[model samples]
Target: MGIFKKPPLRGGKRNAGVPDDLWTKCQCGELIHTLDLKQHAYVCAHCNHHFLLPGRDRIELLTDAGSFEEMDHGLYSANPLGFANYERKTADLREKTGLNDAVISGRATIDSFPVTLAVMDFKYFAGSMGSVVGEKITRAIETATREKRAVIIVSASSGARMQEGMLSLMQMAKTCGALSRHQEAALPYISILTHPTTGGVTASFATIGDINLAEPGCMIGFAGPRVIKETTHQDLPKGFQTAEFMVEHGLVDAIVDRTKMRTKLAELLSYLMPQPSLSGQETLG
Candidate 1:
């Protein structure tokens, strides 16, 4: 009935409800371009809010270009508890996240300072620690010890994976044991706690680092404020779980923004680990 049937709107059609890919809404109620946010290391320009970076993104952000050697790249969970639909869940996450497990362990260089790093991603099952995660982290730490390189763990987890039951709990001990050996070897270990680092992670290796760093506005604790308040039956102080509060209470050594993390880590590594030369190679301590 109409001329040319309205031309069919031409080339392509976009979903009406889909949001623009270039823009993102910050938690502080600010609209920002995704590329601009990334240029700022995903920190909100308006509110200085630190946005969550993917685990692999973090590795790229902190490491020197082309200097990451990943360990246990093919490792994955085995559904040890025979949890219902666990395999499906893991497979979905693996496909979705393109990661074998929640944590990515490897050797990397920050400002060309060699170190062993394990970064947790909340995108995969909230970055919960399972047997694979535990083994991978333990192996990373052991590698650092053998190579005499500093060990760094960036945690963004809801804690241990309950789907694996005791197998998951066992990781706490296993990771801590590896850290102990790393410690006895006199190698420095740094723990960087991002938002929502809690539960069995906080109980074990998360809290036992030689230097503990937390991100601004991040919540770091074993139990959440709600659970603590319900159990204690007392009004907790304001900013109870914030990184600033943790620093004030001596739980965290310092609160560093995400933008400054790589530089700060380099500085700390340079200070704690003085090298004979300016090379990025590992030293035998």
Candidate 2:
């Protein structure tokens, strides 16, 4: 019998589709190695411009190793509106992004301070809030309320999913209601807004957190600048709706750098949930 040999990859590389080396260009016209970018939490090292961080990566960055227990992994979109190509588009997005929906909700600990966490992945349909996404977030908040844990949501969305129509719009109300109950329980809720947190999302739970922190230079508003400009027909002020502008106007509590996000979050969590003493007594402050 003759020995068989496997065919070489089409691109003459072991990993055909994957590039061995990657370089990212910053908006400031600087190029940096991708590994270095990851080291800096995807922020531009030179200009300090914040880049889009994946939801999974964000969770890993903030939580202790092996501390995240995902809550609603099986919940998925069902094409409730029966819109054109809605099912196919959703299926394609699932295969492309490896996400059940835009939002991933779960239980996580920041420096051992337990909290209910939900992160929106923009790669999945612009991180739009659909029925499933809204349901998962609402459930996460409810879970936090029942467990007496803090709730932290990292939002990076363009708005409600248009394909789901009013179904998606209603999620705004549902999530807000859940957060209201969580608030009444006296539990801390932190909302972190990344670039492009807009539309119905801004109108609802995104702005209702006890502490709202936004990434540097992020665009956050109910509508885009062009839409507002056209509607109001007024010359908008410079830096309007940007994170810095919002912070200046007292809209956002602070603008956090991506590199120090984990440290800042851990610090906040520690302040919100002080550790018990060796004698097992927590001092109520």
Candidate 3:
């Protein structure tokens, strides 16, 4: 042998020069790997940036382990007008995202306090609200009322689903109607807005919550920035429609980072509906 080459020492250790495949640094200066970030509840470690979470992932993060009971799991979209490619698009999106629709609705507990949660997944056609989405959300609210549980909604969307045409636009009114019922029940409805909440979703149920919370740097508005600027011929303020701007303008209650969301929500729920004692009185009393 030619002095038996030991794989050139492999950079002094086995696999020593191989780059790690898991970890990545976000633009916000946060060091996170996939699994580690998931373990942190999809929050960036260094900057506490709230990563855009899937609807199901949000439920997993907020709900008590194994406590979530999905409502309306089988509901799906229908192409009433036989619009060309609409059905195929819906089917493809369902397969790609593994979601029945843009919204996921269910009943669960946060910190052991019963609540109903609905989250929108932007991956599902940019989270455009359609008839099925509106129906599912309304039904979820009804279920929560029957169970006497608080309702929480996490909104992340581009707008109404244009593919569904008028049916999609109808969701705006329907969802708002459902939220009105929640108000009538005196049940607290908390809305947490993520990045790019706009269009009919923002115009309706997204803003109807009793307490509105938004993630930092999230854009919450009914219209696109350019469209508004072009319409009014005025310069939009710096950070317009940002979470901080919403807070300053009294639109959003607070700007919460992802890391503290659970704790904050628990506190809010506690304040809204404190636990009852054995005598049917609040312990805080």
Q: In terms of lDDT, which candidate is strongest?
A: 1
Tens-digit lDDT string for candidate 3 (9-46): 45566667657757768778766788898887777777
The reply for model 2, stretches above 4 Å from the true place, is 1-21, 274-285
- Candidate order by TM-score, decreasing, is 1, 2, 3
Q: Residue by residue across 155-200, what tens digits does model 1's lDDT show?
A: 9999989999999999999999999999998889999999889999
Show model 3 residue runs off by greater than 4 Å.
Answer: 1-25, 29-31, 274-285
Candidate 2 — which pairs collide? none
On lDDT, the stronger of 2 and 3 is 2
Full ranking by lDDT: 1, 2, 3
Better of 1 and 2 by lDDT: 1
TM-scores of all predicted structures: 0.91, 0.89, 0.86
Scanning candidate 1 in windows of ten residues, the lowest lDDT window is 276-285
The total of clashing pairs for model 1 equals: 0
